[model samples]
Target: MIRFEDVSVTYDAAPGPTVQRVDLIVPEGELVLLVGPSGVGKSTLLGTVSGLVPHFTGGTLRGRVTVAGRDTRTHKPRELADVVGTVGQDPLSHFVTDTVEDELAYGMESLGLAPDVMRRRVEETLDLLGLADLRDRPIATLSGGQQQRVAIGSVLTPHPQVLVLDEPTSALDPAAAEEVLAVLQRLVHDLGTTVLMAEHRLERVVQYADQVLLLAAPGEAPVLGDPAALMARSPVFPPVVALGRIAGWSPLPLTVRDARRRAGALRERLAGAEPRRATPTEPTPAPGTGRRWAGLRRERTAEALPGVVAASVARLAVRRGRVEALRRVDLTVTPGETVALMGRNGAGKSTLLSTLVGLLEPASGTVRVGGAVPHRTSPRELIRHVGLVPQEPRDLLYADTVAAECAAADHDADAPPGTCRALVDELLPGIADDTHPRDLSEGQRLTLALAIVLTTRPPLLLLDEPTRGLDYAAKTRLVTILRGLAADGHAILLATHDVELAAEIAHRVVILADGEVVADGPTEQIVVSSPSFAPQVTKILAPQEWLTVSEVRRALDAGGGEPW
Candidate 1:
């Protein structure tokens, strides 16, 4: 149904083609997964399907691209709307209406469908995506994951023959992600629809793909083949595949079940050795004192109380309009601790982060950071106590160029010039200073926002969905940087749905359900018990306490031999 013939794309002032000589055919009624590292033109290649590359994005296409027998060169995005439905990484940009129901119906209305037909399709999509409860809620009031579902439902209501998605499940929780993927599976199997998806979180979707298309690097020819064959040599892959490689499996396993089937001996080898646990980087806080260490001391009068808890929330309640987003939530963080806040979509994870960062005022209860109330603290003074990297990275960026943004961060934090730039280089390398923030990919933008926040050097750091678009390599770099920060006596609280990330970095995991704390404990105890929250490694090595690939590697190295 989709064909690319000798395709190559280059921008107005680029040195070479972003995607060079990409030729492939995706059969009808099949799901094709596009896999590659960030900036290797995964998004650029997807844009060619709907004619968004050369036509809408102001680039040059060297060869022909066709979808459903129509050449994209002749058909603009609007012209192909009847057959192609595209959802980019940013769902907020895809929205046109304010309410969930209206957004879902907007696509059919644009197609000039009858009112009855549009209404029926809208209701069907709401049920399919589990958005029935949120149908009446305004899009602005919904959480990030909720917005992602709405965005997907909007495109799905039109009943197009072909669907193109970028990072479709990046924002969704484990359960919600499963629901959405099951719906896509039904579309491919029962309805004979063609799907071309690009995602960074391979663990969630690799097992479902009918075929895999790999773009190894920029200006390199693309490879299309079976999922297992390509995954064996692919540079970026999920944790399960990495574990399979480490154990030297003949055919790499793509799902947890396959890995578990082969993990018996490896688990036995690890039965005697326990995985290393994440501990506090700084000295533990005094017993029952509720006061953190004075590792990052700043002189203050008696009123300032420089030595205090990194973050303390007691009997906290927050309301958005009439909805109680958070209810009587009590939590505390000390210096040199890493805590992960996890929950399903609209379960009040983001709401809690907002309250802590002073973006939302608590309806009732107390919120103190470094002995000062966040809501009452000035923006200037709050920077000294805590820093936040919001879900939407664009919210923290305002400058026209990357260099200007870095300079702005340095000035705001009172740090020396180039401090933010250095952090950016370490997190995501090779980004030119002259590039506009809008010109960057989603992963790059998230990294830049993180670097800017790190410049402030606050005692407490808050990250919301920090790994939304990062590939495995970039995520590893991020894990290294975050670990170093924790060792330097910085308390970190990150709100994320990436279970793998939590397993790799979090010392403790706190789960919230229906705006209340459901469970909180050591990382291994909390994640290993919950089937929904466990990482691939933990699931594969069940009955064992392993949480990540690094842990298994370390155990084997210390023992000095492979199980097989």
Candidate 2:
């Protein structure tokens, strides 16, 4: 059990308390979900439970927090390791060993557990998280999602009474996320474990939570209540809940099953109605030509953009060490298209992105971006054709402050000064220029990295897991920005596990599996057919093929009521 008594946290030279007067109790054997917009102190509040807030983060705590009869104020994180296990947003930062098996056993070793006991827990965790196959793989060689599982298993192996997780499933694919969440449920129900998790992807975890905690805004008093009651008024929510609100369903649904149960009449209402035609922004005109480019049109598609291949891959094969990461994959992107690359963990999605970005040389076949082979193109020349924002945003940022990073981006892209800074401000408002990049929240850092990549305005842009840390509002801003870029004749290829994002933004979806293309087609066609990949809206209104809340709202609005 965890208890927060009059808790308030403030840092040096801060505007105000990050979390103010938060008084609550988390009963044992229950799962509590902390929900809020980014930077509302969700991470800060979680840190208080593990004593990472005022102890290691150099913040001032005004009240007390106790976990399992042990006062966090008196016990440091190491001292509470026996009862508490914490996993932050960045799994790479949580590793202390080289291989998956070693990392899983490291915590128990630190706890001085018997070797036999440690081995048993390690094996159980590996199986529980679906990490058995990856147990022997080095952490550095694993995919982002794989690393995430290893990080989680490391904490779970210690068999702590309390688990505090931050965005636990952000990097996982749909099935993997389900497995991890199910394991957490088992812990809560069968083993009497307490889980306090903070996540931005409410769609994946809201249905699993026993209770909901809402931190509406900075310094605002927190609200604890039933999940349905909280979701009805919560500013940030999953697409299923949003759809429920639109249908005027009593007791807003938290899961796809709940939404589908009440969707029979709504399905009939939309039986004959088709999703609204998307109207992407018109392409900007050429320098001397008043008309739009011949390669693009108002309805952006690859067919319209003839002879305007932004990126082309033909029978591409890439090998990492001895592993065949990608195998004979053929794909094409045109000037005005947004393609989402989707798959499970180790499905070669990231491998293909890396090949396009020229970070990993293809073992065979060809990879061309803007008519030049990406592997052979010089960095300076490549900047004119393509740009990449990787999964780990920190890899693209090395500046001491946000200002310096933006200035460097402008210089590297040969753009006017302050161009990159303006993009950052647009994507995420109110980020101070003087702030260090390392001090930023995960979502903030990813936004800054995206702004840096966007500075070039390259013809082909590739993003890996772009929505990892972004909240719904920030993700909306991002969707608008990306859509505008596509309208401007920029081709975007993003490898992601965020199905909702693909539903909202992608014109097409391509799924890869075990280094092969498994499915590729229009977003509606591909996502609606696959139960694992479908978004909440599509699942709720099955047999209708609707993919997003926006689509349904548009259909209803355009029809002016029931006849839609």
Candidate 3:
């Protein structure tokens, strides 16, 4: 269905060719997963499949590319629309119509399908993607995850032969991700639709992939093979793969069920062992790097941090148009505490974050951060008490360069001039100072926004899907920074779908459903008990309380049992 013959693409401002000599064949009805670190040209490669690489993105494509036996070099995006459906990372940029129903039918209408056929396809897509109840709603009024579904539904109605999605489930909750994955599975099995996806959260999609494409680095040819064989040595992988490596399991498992079958001896070894005690301290850079940075120690203790309340909410309710996004939710977080907010898509997780940060005023009830009401506080006062890193990280960035952004942040926070710069170094190492903000990758942009927020040293920090596009190394750096903040009496709240992240850093867990808090408690008690919310390690070692691979690795290192 898709073929790339010695394809090499270069951009005007890039240091080198974004992708070099990429040759691959994606058979019909197969799901190919594209895995790589940030800024390694996954998006650039996907654009080539849709004839958007040099055609629409103003880059240079040097080799032959074909989809459905039609040469993309000669065909424009519009010409390939019937066979290729491409959904990029930013869903908000893909919309034209106002309502969900119209958006789904627009593509079919463009293809000049009969009115009756368009109507039938629209209804089928609405039910296929679980968007029936939202058909009449305005696209702009929907949450980020809801908008993502609308964007995907809009393209699926075209019945394209191949689907190319960039982080399709990044904004969704665990169950919602499962739903979308299930639909993709159906499309591949029942309809013989080919799929190509690029996702940062490997834990959610790795098991469903038919083959793996690992772009080791920029200007390097991709390695394509079986998923397990590739992930065994790949730096970027899920917790389940990590656990298999630690246990020395042959033919490593891709799913929890596969791991669980081979986990008997591994479980026995860790039965009597306990996780190591973590030494929480600030990170120091290599030899003579001059400044301290945030780095993670990985062995985060399971015990909750105790301190005074940093934020509190009582009977908070939020509404959007006719949708009650959040119910009468009551919540609280204390200093030195890290809490994770989790739920299905459009289940009110974003609404809760918006309410806490003053973006959405609750229709009823109250929200207080550091003893100050968020809705009533001035900008200066609010900056001191609370800071938020939004889902769309660009929302917090407008400066032309990284240096200017740091300088402005330092002036606003009244901190030393180099404070924000050091934080940026800690979050995203080796990023050039003179580079334009728009030129940075999605993950780097988020890191910069996070650094800006951290420079303020706000007592209450809130992040929405903070690890959306980060690789393992970058995510580890983020883990260290967040753990340092929690240790220093900063109350941190994260809204995320990455179960592995919640497993490693969060001390408490709160699950929301239909705008109401369905479950709230310690991280282990909450996540390990739920099938959908459990992390990879917890799923493999079920009936036990294990939550992360690091914990088990620590136990094994402490003489849990002999290795196989």
Give each model a TM-score.
Answer: 0.96, 0.95, 0.93
Which residue ranges in model 2 land beyond 4 Å of their true spot?
279-307, 562-564
Query: What's the true lDDT of residue 84 in model 1?
Result: 97
lDDT of each: 0.89, 0.88, 0.84
Single out the weakest 10-residue window by summed lDDT for candidate 3: 296-305
Cand. 1 TM to true fold: 0.96
How many residue pairs clash in each candidate at the backbone level? 0, 0, 2
Top candidate by lDDT: 1
Q: Please provide, for model 3 over 174-279, each residue's C-alpha lDDT reduced to its tens digit, 9 standing for 90 to 100.
A: 7778888898999999999999999889989999999999997777899888999999878788888899888888798999899999999887777776654222
Clashes of 3: 2
Model 1, position 557, has a per-residue lDDT of: 94
* lDDT, candidate 2, at 110: 96
lDDT over C-alpha atoms for residue 30 of model 1: 93
Which of 1 and 3 is ahead in lDDT?
1
Please give the ranking of all candidate structures by lDDT, highest first, separated by commas. 1, 2, 3
Q: After superposition, how far is residue 453 of candidate 2 from its true place, in Å?
A: 0.5
